[model samples]
Target: MHTAITSQPLPSAAEAALARESSRVLSACLQTRSDAQQIELHDEQGATHPVRVPVSALRLLLDVLTEIGAGNAVSIIPIHAELTTQEAADALNVSRPHLVRLLEQGDIPFHKVGTHRRVRYQDLMAYKQRIDAQRHEALDALAEEAQRLGLGYD
Candidate 1:
């Protein structure tokens, strides 16, 4: 999968300031629907133009800008992009061999591309979400059991 990320150098001071303001504007704009979701862009020539962007895209842009403002590295990978087994394993924070076993057990779906397996980014995300939810549920159940046994306090 192709990931879009900022280069090594983080955003400049001015860019960080702009990112803060843009984050506010994008957050506010996403909460309400206007006739057009537009933002002004200023070019090096000092010319300003309005550009329309989808609300979903604006949300992502806002998140990226916020992360950059906080001096964090950000990467955007398309949900539909295909990833190699190693890449998928990295995404899941699992070993490549373990990931392959999961694939063999039909835990995650995949497709073969000329003898090489490829997993969609969306599928990986889905599996991660499911696992996270299951973990949360199990934790909650354990907490409840502890409370019932007087091991947990209010």
Candidate 2:
């Protein structure tokens, strides 16, 4: 499997401002009923070029712009991509050893590549969603119990 890791520095204040403006404009443009839109780009030398972009791609670009405008870093991973233990751990915000334990315990679906283990991005996301839902359920139950006990929880 071919995996590409890309890391970019956070946007500067000026860049963020530009991203905010650009996203706002793109959002307005996307309200039209069309599969594709024509957008114009201006070069540094005062040259203009018109390009047609698919609506789906434009929507994705808008999302990226919005995140950058909010000063958040973004990374794109294909659903079918295979990730290393460290990469999967980083995606789940957990330690590598913990991810390894989960893999060994069959908590998440993974496969062995020779002697190394690789996790599919889709399987990892599914595991994360399941765990998050369970945590939410537990929290809700705890809150309900607290309310029943009249512990002054609003």
Candidate 3:
């Protein structure tokens, strides 16, 4: 019953627009994926929406689905648990260098057995939580600012 998104505040007009645009683009992309299986989203509020997108549709959605589904609310079966540096970076929605910085910061624990850095499943989940929280905070702040300025989505 865990969600990637934490409720703090609403999203701003710009954030909403960006999300809408991204959704439109993603919907188009998902429509194009031959293997994209429509996923049915059942929100905690008892709302349900169906979308069929494959793992290759984009890295983020795949990771989200993986995270939610990995826990008590496991969506689909978990994919790769142990991933390489590039793969972990892709999953974290960041570049390799950024992930390395996170690794150095100890935001995510990694192992260097030999010359390769390997990120574990638990580490990836923690990183996702941190990333999601920051996004939520930014969107919340942006929305509040927009409201204070009388900005409208229309």
Top candidate (TM-score) = 2
TM-score winner between candidates 2 and 3: 2
Judging by lDDT, tell me the better candidate of 1 and 3: 1
Residue-level lDDT for 11 in candidate 2: 92
Candidate 2 similarity to native, TM-score: 0.92
Q: What lDDT does the true structure give each of the candidates? A: 0.83, 0.92, 0.65
RMSD of 3: 15.9
Better of 1 and 2 by lDDT: 2
Ranking by lDDT: 2, 1, 3
Q: How far is candidate 2 from the true structure (C-alpha RMSD, Å)?
A: 1.5
Clashing pairs in 1: none
Single out the weakest 10-residue window by summed lDDT for candidate 3: 1-10
Model 2 lDDT per residue over 1-154, tens place: 8475467789999989999999999899899788999999999998999999999999999999999999877888888999999889988999999999999999999998999899999999999999999999999999999999999998
Best-to-worst ranking by TM-score = 2, 1, 3
| C-alpha RMSD between model 1 and the true structure | 3.1
Q: Tens digit of lDDT per residue, candidate 1, span 1-154?
A: 5443223577788888888887887787788665458779999999999998877787788889998778666677787888888888888889999999999999899999889888888999999999999999999999899989998566
Give residue 75's error in model 1 in angstroms: 1.6
